[model samples]
Target chain A: MVLDGIAKTALLGVEMGMTLVLVTVGLTLIFGMMDVINFAHGSLYMLGAYFGLTVVSVTGNWWAALLIAPLLVGLLGGLIEYFSIRPLYGRNPLYHILLTFGFAIMLHGLVTEIWGGQVQNISTPALLDGSVDLVLFSYPLFRLFLLGVSIAVTAALWLAIRQSDFGIVMRASAHDSEMVNALGTDVKRVFTAVFVLGSVLAGLAGVLLGTSQAVDPGMAASIIIQAFAIVVIGGLGSYRGAVVGAFIVGMLNAFGPTFAPQFTDALLYLLMAAVLLVKPAGLFGNPEAT
Target chain B: MSVKDIVGRHFSAHAETDVLSGRVRLGLFVAGVVAVLFAPVAQMIHPFWMDLVTHMFIFALFALSLDFVFGYAGLLSFGHAAMFGAGGYAAALLIQNVTSSALLVLPAAVIIGAIVAAIIGWLSVSARGIYFAMLTLAFAQLFYTIAFNDIPAMLLGVDAVTNGDNGLVGITSLTLFGMDTGSLMSYYYLALVILAGMLALVTRLANSPFGRVLQAIRENEDRVAFIGYNVDRYKIVAFTISGAMAGLAGGLWVPFNSTATTSMLHWTTSGELIVMTLLGGMGTLWGPIAGAFLVVFLEDSLSAIGNWEIYLGIVYIVIVIFAPRGLAGIFQTVRSNPHPKVLLSRVRSALVTYREKVFS
Candidate 1:
């Protein structure tokens, strides 16, 4: 029975780990490329879930909304970047921090205002509705589906960023935007694409999260803090680091509760603090970046 | 005109003017305080407004302390609530366990705030910029959880410590020499005296060599380090001082509300102080006070309306976009203008040009 419980816990950990990996990778990509610490990343995720919820409610099809919601979020993100964040470029980073934070608050407030403060739950798709018997215990099939989706998404993203011509441009821009611009690449277009891509990833996470757990007004702040912690732990701007960091956090989140229920929530951050103290540059952070 | 020359000319013009206007500004500051002091009596019919002003002053202290870290030290702390919460907890605990003497509790609150700040400063000062901010925030959240979830059971038994989520109830009223003078009138006066003393200290410290060195560090930390200053030590000290002052505000809040809760230590509380400092204008001594007043008033009046968060979010967006320097920045521009009307016109034209060139 104890062994069964442990296996079940490990499975749950893997599923949670996948979700964190998705969110952290998107955040790291944005931060890596722009040197912009996006305080609004979680808001984008929340928006995705809300938008997905709205779509699902209308069409009564969860999978369709999951696919479409992120595209819409991506467009909105591009517009936000075009208007609000552009002015703060080359200014004090505090300006960016405040601007993004203000944007986040506005988004959260709007979400709360439009859709009352009540929590909304999204049912798992019909195909993944039941539990899968895993030897001695049963686990939710939808969680396994989420894990599969996340793995596919991560692999697809890796290939897209590594092999495509656009990836070449993106890498060059990330290394030195000024140099890329000097080389006559359309830097603005590249940045817009990257920003939208990052937003879509965040939206994807939100859709998956909404399906896995309930959605509510307060979820934005909670997820954002967790994402930030994940990013920090993973080594800012390092995609692989984000994946590794997310699993570590996920397993800790799942198991820490059984040991120290009260301090369970804090364990993730404590891990981050320890990691940071030991490796100030993070697990994957370039020493030169700091 | 080159950028350096223009900057030099601007400073030279203002340098002489400041010497002449110091007395005027000081007089105005005093007059402003006096008006605030008399406001309750003048508006005795509206205790609601008096309460709002009182709350504003309490928060203004919080904002000012935040500016010390943000504006002066160039550190954006996410855990400033540590000081604020520590102060509140200290005062509440002291009131409950030791004595209800306002004087004793007040000083004790500051000491408690300082100790908490010292601990946090030690942990956080090693970091810079966003890392520092996030770490502080993480620590602050941990502190909040400890207070809200863990402390009640561990420190004061399950029902004893904070009264749980219901919060500490029936805090002892302020008594000076066994006289019950703990009315709103007295609280207002007490807050005013404390605010005045704080402002005086801030001004003195701001003008002191220590303050200049801190500003220099803000401008160029590497350069400051090269000049043989212990950069980290100075940062720790400045952060500790700011934390202590925030705690002072927290301590005062206990009597002002006659209760203290874990709510005082939440990230939202820290965010509010940041907003106040930003709104009032960072770095300016009185800017935080003004910000506190404006934000508190806005929140108070707007909370009655549905979707006040939307309004606040809109306000924050607009201010950050248009008034990055905040209200005090506007004051500075007006004060500096040789011809205020012409300057206003020039600003308007400049805005139009900026819209055409960049924003639009």
Candidate 2:
């Protein structure tokens, strides 16, 4: 019985961690490539869920909504990059922070105005509605599918980033944009693309998690803080660090309630504080960059 | 002269004029304060307007406190409302459980705010730039979660003090030296006096040697550290001072509003304060106060329109892009250029300089 409880908790942790990974990886990538902290990232995620919900309701096809929502968000993100963010490149990071923060508020207002401030529900598709019998216990098939989808998406992203010529240029530019620019790479286009990719990932996470939870306008405000925490704990701009941090946070969040439900929220932040105290640059981040 | 030389000439001219204008501003400030002090006696202002002004003073103090760390010390704290809310909660709890004296509650609130700031500052000061900002934010959220979710009762086995989302109400007004503070007019005077005192105190601090070091750290941390100064210690001190000031603002808010809510500590509250600070003019102590008044007044008037957030966002974006120096910069520009032709040329030159700074 104890083993079964442990197994269940582990599963829950992985499920939560996958969702977090989807968000934080994108956040970390944007920070790495552009040095711009996208405060609107979570808002984009919220928008994705709202878009997915609207699309699914209108089309009656969940898969089509999933494909379309992220694309739409990515397009919006690209436009934002071109118009607002592109100008504040060489200025202090604070400019981008403020600009993004304003964008987040504006987006939230737009979302509320369009959808009205209500909890939105998205039903699971029929194919993934029931529970699946595991060796030890029955698990929600939808949740299992979510985990699989997250894994597949992450794997595909990893392969694309690791193997492609575009990936090499991206990695190089993140290190030294001036050098890449000198090498005839269009660094501006690269940055725009990176931002779009990040926004798309955020949108994807939104859709994936929106099905399980109720979506509201305020959803972005809360999740963004956690996503930021994940990015910080993992070490800013480090992919492996983000993944590791996500799992640690996800597991802690999953099991913290069992031991002390009230302290669960504090636990995540406390853990982050402790990590920062010990390793100021985060576990995998460069100290010099910090 | 070459453009660089022309810019250099203007810079020196502006500096000389600034010193002269400083005295003029100070005189004007005193006049403004005297006018406000006599506003209650004029009977021309409504009680509702008095209340709004009082609320503006409280937020002005809050924004000023934020400016200490953000504008002066060059630390962008995203969790500053934790200090503000902590002050409010501390004062409320004191009033509810311990004493009804404004004197006691207010001081306790300041101390509690300082203590909270110290703790958060100690943890976060080690990180620089965006990390420092995020760390402060996370810690603030931790406190917010504790207050919002009744975490203290479940974790520490204490009674829920923050009262969850409903917030703590029924805080009675205190009498000070035979005068009741519950009256709207009296509270307005009290808040105004306190704000004036705090503003003077902060202004003095900003002009001191320590303030100079704080500004120096903002400009270049490595250089300051290389000169044998403890950069981390200075940052912690600034954070603590700023937090205490914010706390004082929060403390004043509870008595003025007769309620304290956990929503005060929410991230959005911090964001709003940032907007106020940025809108007024960062790095300028008095700008935040004006910014606060402008924001609160606009919020009051435009709230009926029901799209204040969008307007505020557009305003912020515009300010960041066009007037990076903020509303205060426009005043400075106007002050330096008394003629339209010179002002136009100066504005054009300023834009060119800004573009070069940003794009090059």
Per-residue lDDT for B1-360 in model 2, tens only? 699999999778755533114754686488467747665654465677888888898999999999888988899999988999999998888888887677887888899899999999988897888878888888898889889887766667776778888889988775577677888877787788788888778777876678878988999999999999999999999999999998999999998888999889998899989989998888787778888988898888876888677777888887877787788877777877779999889778867865664354
lDDT of 2 by residue, A234-265 (tens): 88887777788888988988898888777888
Q: Identify the CAPRI category of the predicted complex in candidate 2.
A: medium
The worst-scoring run of ten residues by lDDT in candidate 1 chain A lies at: A281-290
Q: DockQ of all candidates, in order?
A: 0.48, 0.54
Question: Which 10 successive residues of model 1 chain B have the least lDDT summed?
Answer: B15-24
Please report the candidate that would top lDDT against the real structure: 2
lDDT of 2 at B140: 91
Q: Rate the local accuracy (lDDT) of all candidates.
A: 0.79, 0.84
What DockQ score does model 2 reach against the true complex?
0.54
- What TM-score fits each model? 0.92, 0.92
